[model samples]
Target: MARATTAHQLHDLGLAAWFGGTLANAVALNKAAAHSGDAASTGAVANEGWDRWTPVNAAAIGAHLIGSVGLLKHDLGRMSVQKGVGSMALAKTAVTIGALGVTAYSRVLGRKVSQHHAVPAADGTTPTASTPPDVAAAQKKLKQLQWAVPALTGAIVAIASYASEQYRPEEVHRGMLQRVLP
Candidate 1:
């Protein structure tokens, strides 16, 4: 069994953090916030949690991107010669880009919603409702995006798993031969 490189470890750990964080936010944080009281309070609570998490999430994403580049550099030869590897890489890249976009859009929506709500300063007090039509629309969009972030991150995790399986020696050999032969 070969020891995993630093890049591989970072890539896996970063991805784990990204996936786990998104899922936790969706399942636990959002639900807890929704139970906080009215719509404004819910948005404020959820936004506050996400705001606290943004820095950590950004770091995880940075690490994952850097590690992915390093891993790709290390595997350039196999990427060029292997049959399925390039396709899987492309798929992973596409999903990653999509996830990034969704995350950004979700943040934008969150910020828009936050503008109308009175976020609690320190005390865990329920905020007053001030949901204008536009803010309500933004909140709706955010609700959908909340689930999307997790779904996309989970897809990335699945793609990473597939890529790992493709890295097996037997799989790599078969992939290269298939490219050359067919």
Candidate 2:
């Protein structure tokens, strides 16, 4: 296989690891919530969920963006187009749709989480990962930050789709054709 293929495969693997890792972290957070009763600690699961998810979405968006571009590059000309039609086309369409769907879903979830409210701690302090706040305002802020994942992911998906459209092989090749042939 070509180096590019190897790189793509590695990138995909990284994404899979991150997604799985994020979910695992979420699970761990739930367990922590179950085991602990400290007011500062009760919602740690949601907190960690917010933390882990941000990077997960960011990584996912990056991977999809790159993948779309890669596919577009592979889709130019007669032989390539022939390979892309049928099952390949279906697969491509699925990926595009899935990215958009996930991005939208993530955004919605992020918004919901952000809107959630919590009581302020008796002591004034910004909630840190180490000191999970017992208060509502802090909880709300944490929830908003949790969406870093989805927002980043959506941004990535949006950018990749744009790149795929812009760098489409035919478009890239058109410029080449004019330069070379004319």
Candidate 3:
């Protein structure tokens, strides 16, 4: 029979999954918007993406709440061995770093693209200083994405590390399986 899981274990697992899924969705949407250069789409995506965090963060907080209540209850259950938590954490770190780098690249691209484009001011005169509203809006979202993606990626690492430690203590325990299997 499996040992009982500490409340902390469940919380980490839930948060890791939530953060990972959220980051993936945001990154995918941002990529699509970047490709299409659609301001409405980008802005809408940004709005939805950013808004998702309100509830998600709340859920994570709720996990903490549940964890705190663990004192009132007996053991819930032992966390299963999550095979890929360590790999997932490492992968997440790489992705996050890449996302940050992409942010810089995106900003440079936006500036260059804006230089070739023009936007109409309130007077309807095209401003040489900026791109059109649609283009500008899209760029603005990209700018936000540049920072957001990497930040989210980092969160994935943090979440993964927390989850992995609880589910896979083997690396710390240094199981005899390492000796036998090798």
Q: Report the backbone clash tally of model 1.
A: 0
lDDT of each: 0.75, 0.46, 0.45
Worst 10 residues of 2 by lDDT: 117-126
- For residues 100-133, write the lDDT of model 3, one tens digit per residue: 4554454454444334332222111111133455
Model 2, 48-156: lDDT tens digits are 4554566666676566457545554554443242332334445545655664565455445444433332211221113334443334444444344334433444444
| Model 1 score (lDDT) | 0.75
Clashing pairs in 3: none
- Ranking of all predicted structures according to lDDT, beginning with the best and ending with the worst: 1, 2, 3
Instruction: List, residue by residue over 1-182, the lDDT tens digit for candidate 1.
Output: 12237778878888888878977887788678767665657767877887788889888988888878877777777889998888888898899899999988877876776675544322122223445666667766766777787798889889889989988889988998999995
Per-candidate clash tally: 0, 5, 0
lDDT of 2: 0.46
TM-score of each: 0.85, 0.46, 0.36
Model 1, residue 58: what's the lDDT? 86
Per-residue lDDT, model 3, residue 18, is 46
